[model samples]
Target: MYKAHFGLREQPFGITPDTSFFFACPSYQEALNTLLIAVRNGEGFIKITGEVGVGKTLLCRKFMTTLGDEFVTAYIPNPFLEPRALMFALADELEVSLEKDVDQHQLLKSINHRLLVLARAGKRVVLCLDEAQAMPLDTLEALRLLTNLETEKRKLLQIVMFGQPELNHKLQQEAIRQLNQRITFHYHLGPLNKDDMEFYVSHRLSIAGYTGGRLFGSSAIQAMYASSGGVPRLVNILSHKALMLAYGEGKHEITARHVRAAARDTGAARNKIWFLGWLAAAALITVGTSIGWAYFK
Candidate 1:
């Protein structure tokens, strides 16, 4: 809504995992590089773990987008399925034809055939599973089995799992130890640090065609860092709200007050001191007024 007012072609703080708006902060860059290097090395299973709203999905989308033509990429955004259903999802992504009511064995055979064909054609097939912690145990084991289909040199189907930190706990399960062991390159994506957050917000704004002075002031940036804990998604949310409030109030610059108000409205930052101080001062003012009235009477 404020895009025109902000002089931008699009909303800068959108929550969508748009690869175009991706900010290459240090941690995310490292994670992407780690995935690229590991996959190039024919690593059977590469895993990225991060907390919710830490931009794992965004990083995954960017990686797949930039992965280029040498690889055939299949993305499974939601992996909460039975072994048979999981196979169907992968098949659908790979464009492997499936007849109606095909049994599990037949489906697996078709997938294996497709993987082999891609391998022969000098194409690397990568299966990227997002939200992988929700994947069924049997399905994860099935994925491990798929990795077994390999030439003498490298594995046929490379797997990259992007998931919440729960995925690590899932990996620790004894049942999926083989899959866990196969994860040679692992990157845990954490929130951006304070300095990174400053750049991240500005970088996103610049990408969205923001031209002019810095929209977010330094104190406002500090408040953003404090409130968002440097999480990109949270920063986007808080910053977007602050922008709307600023625009509504006829302000061009985003101040710390604007950020705090946004935080209060958003149930983020949760600065009890602000509220508590307001309450305490109100109590004192009320008492003083009452005493003055009594003396006047």
Candidate 2:
């Protein structure tokens, strides 16, 4: 609705994990590089943990896109199935055909054969599981056992897990200690800093076809950083709402007032009294400066 108003071709702050909107901040870039290196090295098990809305899914998608034709990738976005179902899903992703009468052992054999074929063909096979923290304990163990299918030189199928912080806790369980020991690489995604947040917002907006100069002023950006705590998803939500507020007011640039209004409306402004007080102070200073400039001129 506000695209035309803001001269943007599309919504800049959608919550979807769009790789095109990815901002390669220092932390995110490092995480990507680590994943690439770990996967390329045939690391048997890799884990990336991040808080909710910290761009974990985006990073995961970016990794998949970058791997491209170099690797055969199976992405399991939801891994909450039972052990057998999980294996079936992986088999389906790998294009391992199984008849309706096929049982779990038959499915595993098919998958293992496919992995060995891919390995012999000099192709790296990667299984990326998202939301892995929700996976049942037995399912996780089943996955670890699958990693045992390896050649003398390297593991046949590399596994990459992206999940919330709870995934780490789950891995610490005594029953899953074997899987934990196999994790050759691990990274914890942190929130973006204030500067990164500013760049991230501007980058997404520019990609969405915003050619005009800064639409969100410094104060608004600061407010956004505070409100969102530098979390990408929260930043998207607040920035989108702020843009809508600005468009509704027929304003070309988003001011602190618009940000505050959006924050209040979204119930994200934690320090409401402080934010309103600053707004009042800024308004007074603007009015006073305007009067003095007019009188002097």
Clash counts per candidate, in order, are 0, 0
TM-score against truth, every candidate: 0.89, 0.89
**lDDT score for candidate 2 against the true structure:** 0.92
Tens digit per residue, CA lDDT, model 2, 87-206: 989998999988898987888999999998988788999999999999999999999999999888998999999999999999999999999999999999999999999999999999
The alpha-carbon deviation from the true structure for residue 254 of candidate 1, after best TM-score superposition, in angstroms, is: 0.1
**What local lDDT does model 2 show for residue 207?**
96
Measured by lDDT, the strongest candidate is 2
| Candidate 2 TM-score versus the reference | 0.89
Q: Please list all clashing residue pairs in model 1, or write none if there are none.
A: none
Q: Against the true structure, candidate 1 has what lDDT? A: 0.90
Q: How high a TM-score does candidate 1 get? A: 0.89
Cα lDDT for residue 2, candidate 2: 93
Instruction: Write the residue-wise lDDT of candidate 1 on 127-210 in tens digits.
Output: 999999898888999889989988888888999999998899988999989889989999999999999999999998999999
Candidate 2 scores a C-alpha RMSD against the true structure in Å of: 10.5
> Which segments of candidate 1 are over 4 A away from where they belong?
268-297
